[model samples]
Target: MSPAASKRQADLLKQEGNAFFQKERISAAIDAYTGAITLCPNVAVYWTNRALCYKKRNEWTKVEEDCRTAIQLENHSVKAHYMLGLALVNRQKLSEGIKALEKSLELGRGAHPASYMVEAIWQQLSKAKYIEWESLSRERATQLRKLKVACKEAICNYNSLGNPAADAPEEQLNELEEVFKKAAKTDTPTEVPDHLCCKITLDIFRDPVITPSGITYERAALFGHLHMVGKFDPVTREALEPHQLVPNLAIKEAVDSFLSEHGWAYKIR
Candidate 1:
């Protein structure tokens, strides 16, 4: 067959693989993608598609191999790099995964800015970072998790009281606020811990915000970055808008507690 004919045949197989994949016929999708790759070894998409099938099967080694082959065939293959990053992270090669994800983000920004896959890539990167952070600070991470739970419980109890009438006793609301504020303020540390600081501002968060990507940052700092820099998240490079940020009340409470305990941490240079 001529090269054009061969490519067309490969395209048909790829489309078949896509259909199978969408149907969740993972093994059949793999077979179709493999057929495409055999027919058009030079096509990066064939390898990437096969890699995705392997990913669905939790076959990290095969995913890594196929994505590497795809990247070799087409250096600018965004899906390949993104998949490779996920495979690497699954294999506990976090640093390499982060680099691959960053490369994918860089390449994808110009070519496929609106692709939904970009969000997945960013989420994977975020997971990798969280894993790394947890590994390094397991104890502190546990503490933070507990603190978040406590904060949530506090909020839930307050809300369960129901909406008070506008004129009904302002003192009651103020008293409740003071109680929690006092709890957070009871123990001031001499120095602010690194984990408590916002990654973007390198300072304590006054108002913490969480993005859909599961990253937390200072509200104003993240808002500014989204508006002034780009719509992509700072940590994961995922697409995000200011409106997508949710107030991370738990983290906010935790930060407030930390600050209260370590009043000196509030002294910013």
Candidate 2:
């Protein structure tokens, strides 16, 4: 086959894979994308598409392998990095995963600040950062507790040695105690404001939409409720439909501005 014909064939396979993926036929989608990759081995998107299929099945190793190939083929591929980050996270490689996620966020923001993917990448990065922060905070607290116990022991030994004039160990113990108290206070989790959250998902607004009744919800969550539950506002129980929802630009901008300063808001439960 000529290169042009092979490229055309790969494009057709990609479309088939997309259709299969949309239908939730993940195995078939993977096979289709594999065919595309076989036809056009240098194409980065084919590898990423197959990686997404693996991701759906929780096959972290396959996802990582395919994403790495995609990244090698196209270093600046945002989806490649994003999926790689998720794959690494599933594999329990948090630090590496966070780096990949941060790269994806940076690329996505540069390419399309208003794209759905930019927000998705930002949210994932924020959650990863929060998890890392929480883990480190716990470890530090544990170390501080151990240090406090040891400091008190040292002070006791110093006093028992008939060295009551030795203020050095006692002063160190007081300083350590004060540091532990401050750490405890600083580690307390802050609550996210309810107004910033979607009623159905109770998550920070991603694509917020307001209904006629002045109730706002995450776009996808509201769509799910309307399709699966009923065409009424989840909060007010008022009559509503998918068409009644309007993009709340004011709220969206507010949420975006807040997240710019407080990425930790993505730590929503």
Question: lDDT of all predictions, in order shown?
Answer: 0.77, 0.84
Model 2 lDDT per residue over 1-269, tens place: 99999999999999999999999999999999999999999999999999999999999999999999999999999999999999998788999999999899779856854467877887787778677767877787798788878878877887779875676765767887887787676556655678889877787886688899988888777877887899888878888977777889898898877655443534566
Off by over 4 Å in 1: 138-269
Inter-residue clash pairs, candidate 2 = none
How close to the true structure is residue 93 of candidate 2, measured as C-alpha lDDT?
A: 91
Report the lDDT of model 2 for residue 6.
Answer: 98
Steric overlap count per candidate:
5, 0
Give per-residue CA lDDT, model 1, range 8-126, as digits (tens): 99999999999999999999999999988888899898999899899989999999999999999999998999999999998999889989997887687557443556556656765
